[model samples]
Target: MEWTLWFSYILLSFVVITLVHSLLLPNLSKIRRIEGVPLVSVLVPMRNEVRNVKGMVDSVKKQTYKHIEVFFLDDESTDGTSSALELAVRGDARFKVLQGKPKPEKWIGKVFACHQLSEAAKGDYLLFLDADVRIQPEAVERALGLMQQKNISLLSGFSRFILPTWLNKLLVPLQHFFVLFHLPILLANWTKWPPATAAHGGFMFFERSAYQAIGGHAVVKENIVEDVAISKRMKAEGYRMWIANITSVASCRMYETNAEVWQGFTKNIFNGIGRSIPLAVGIILFYGVVYVGSGILALAALLVEERVLLLPYLLIILQAGIVYLNTREPLALAFLLPVASVAFILLLVSAMRKSVKGQQVEWKGRYYG
Candidate 1:
């Protein structure tokens, strides 16, 4: 019992400390302002982004940088998105809406659209952004400056979450925990080991040279979680990559409702964890036992007045609280970790089932599966 308690405490301590370090510690890369403001092409691949396209287009128009051209790709969206983009791009010489080429049977929707956009892009730097994300006026300038200063090839980071409901707060914010706890950013740029690769496709900037060298989006045309795969490939191929907390520069509402959240997470959860059944099962069980078992043990300790066992359980709760607080997820959701664990397993099972049946994942209105 003592050995078990000590091991659990050690694991909890390690996890909490790592997360805190990643969030609190800053990476001090020398950021330089874009020298002479290099021409940048902002490419947005859209499918049924009617609710988001106009605003994203307008946001680019408001950029502080002058030599910017925006290319919007309508990936066969049937939700009146093309009409919205047409109206938005009308008479705007800097913005052009391109009809997406037919998706090759082998290519994923985003990668195919992105590949087409890259072929048409005329900028020295290519910024791939999702239609759902809104960028501030200075974002382009800041990214260019950071890229120049850090001497890095890719600038990938997350944006602020614009959650409007409790459900969004619960599920959407859990992604912070997902990224932070699993892939700590503090150790991502260390020189000793391969950097922990991560990128939010909602906002990513890459040099045209690097993009072309890495084979562009065409390389990972079939990956469901395309961004992470791309980042990993880039890192493995020796392109410098860095991620910052870009919460101040941009914002995104990943999903509007609970159903949207479920669909969104279900599509990528398995892929994010590497599609390993044994690993996924182990994670689900690990969290279930520690988080769920701790709660039950705490309750039993309360009823039986077992102070010795209660101390460790209390420490576990403290660890969970710190994790929740740092992740910005609702603390109440901590108690439902077991439920979330089960849901994640079910999502992975669904994803694997589809993959085995020669089907892939789907998002928005398109069936990439």
Candidate 2:
């Protein structure tokens, strides 16, 4: 029993060490700007985004670069999203609003929309963004600059969210923490290792040449988590892909309520890691035990005066504390990581149950497993 505890402590300590190193020596590559304006096409896929469609369309209309073309694909949205887009783009000559064709049997909705957008794109570079994202005035210009300076084929940025409610504050911050601590973008870029990446899918910039070389959406047509898959495929095919914290430049409200967050996450959470149940369950179980269990042991050690175990307990506490701090969550919610970890496990279990029955999860008022 003692050995098991010690072994767990050591394993978790390694993860902590990696995270700590990530914090102290975060190697963020500098963002560079292109010398002149580059012809860019921005593609947005929309479905039932009535509340947000107009604002997103307006945001693009306000871009600093005038050489950009905008394509807004309406994916059979029934909630008057099409009309809203029509009104938003009516006076703008650069903006073209097209209706998305029906999703084919083997293709995911987003991928199919993107594939169609690519066919209609008439620029040297393609920017794929979700309908909900609102970019700052210079977002596209800055992204193009960074792409040119870094010589990267793909550029992905993380966006900030409007936490209008307490539920948003509690859950959304944890997602950011996982992105920072568990999958630090700096480590992937600095070490010449394959970048384990996260993107706001809300905002992505891709070179047309790289998109073609890697086979574009056609390669990942069936994947629900096509963004990440596309990034990985791009890297594997020897194209440069860069990810950075672009939270300052753009923001979105992914969900407004707790139920919305659950449904939104469920749409792709299971398939994000893989559709395999055992793989998802094993990961949830392992992390829950290591992160949550270690904290439990540390608390008991303090209460029961287990002096011999004090060092390991302290190590666990320190590791978790550092991760919490880096996460930038409100101190109270951040400290409740054990609780959050448990919640994640429950969500994974829920996903597994649904996937087992071949059930499709709903998103944007449409169902996809």
Candidate 3:
């Protein structure tokens, strides 16, 4: 029992350290625009994104960068996505809406759409963005400036969450927590190791030449988690890839309701953890122990008059507090840390079970087997 408490303390300490490191990491800055304007192609792969098209395109149209051409590929969206896009563009010469081709054999939908967009892009840099993302006017200029100043081949940054629903407020922050706490930003940037590389699909910026060299989305055509796969490939090929916090410049509302959140996360969470059952199980168990188990143990200790167990419980709360602060979640949410942790554990287990049973993962009205 004493050994178990000590182990829990060690794990909680590690989490707190990681959270502190995440907070210390710097945000991407807005540098002055470069001399000659370089043409940038902004790619959006839309499938049933009618609700997001207008706002997304409006944001793109408002970019401060002068030499950007926006491409919106309609991936056979059955909704009013095409009409919304057309209305958004309003026949702007800089914005073109293309009809996406049918998915090729064994190719995923989004990757196929992206591949077509890349083939049609005529620019020095290619920026792939999700339709749900909203960017500030200076987003493009700032990102380009950072790329040029750092000599980056591929640059990806995290977006802030616009949590509207109750479940969203509780769960959306986990995205930041997963990346910031588990992956050390400093080590990822300084190391050439593939495992250390991290990228977000919401905002992926790449130099045209380097993108082509890495084969763009073609290399990750079938991967559900294409962003991480591309980041790994880039690092493996000796390309300089940088990942930073761009929350100040961009935000995304990934899911609106509880069902959407569940489906969206279930589709990729297993693969996100390396698609290894052992690793999945280990992660779930570790989180359960540190976050959920500690709370239960503390209550039991209180009932049985065991004072030693309270130490681990306090450590868990401290760890949760750090995570909340780093992820910008409300401090009040820390009190619900145990509940949230249990919810996350259940989600992880559900994802793992589905993957193990060969159940098809559904997203955007398509199934990934």
Per-model C-alpha lDDT, please? 0.74, 0.74, 0.84
Candidate structures ordered by TM-score, highest first: 3, 1, 2
Q: Which of candidates 1 and 3 is the stronger one according to lDDT?
A: 3
Task: Name the candidate that leads on TM-score.
Answer: 3
lDDT of 1 by residue, 204-251 (tens): 799889888989898999988888788877787788877766666677
Candidate 2, 246-313: lDDT as tens digits: 66567777787888877877777788878887789687887677657756766777898775444544
Candidate 1 segments whose C-alpha is farther than 4 A from its true place: 1-8, 23-32, 164-167, 184-187, 191-195, 298-339, 349-362
Off by over 4 Å in 3: 1-12, 32-35, 298-314, 317-320, 323-327
User: Residue 55 of candidate 3: its Cα lDDT?
Assistant: 90
- By summed lDDT, the worst window of 10 consecutive residues in model 3 runs over 24-33
The RMSD (Cα, Å) of candidate 3 is: 2.3
Off by over 4 Å in 2: 1-31, 165-167, 184-187, 190-197, 294-332
What TM-scores do the predictions have?
0.85, 0.83, 0.92
* lDDT winner, 2 or 3: 3
Displacement of the residue 70 alpha carbon in candidate 3, Å: 0.5
Root-mean-square deviation of candidate 1? 3.3
Candidate 3, pairs of clashing residues: none
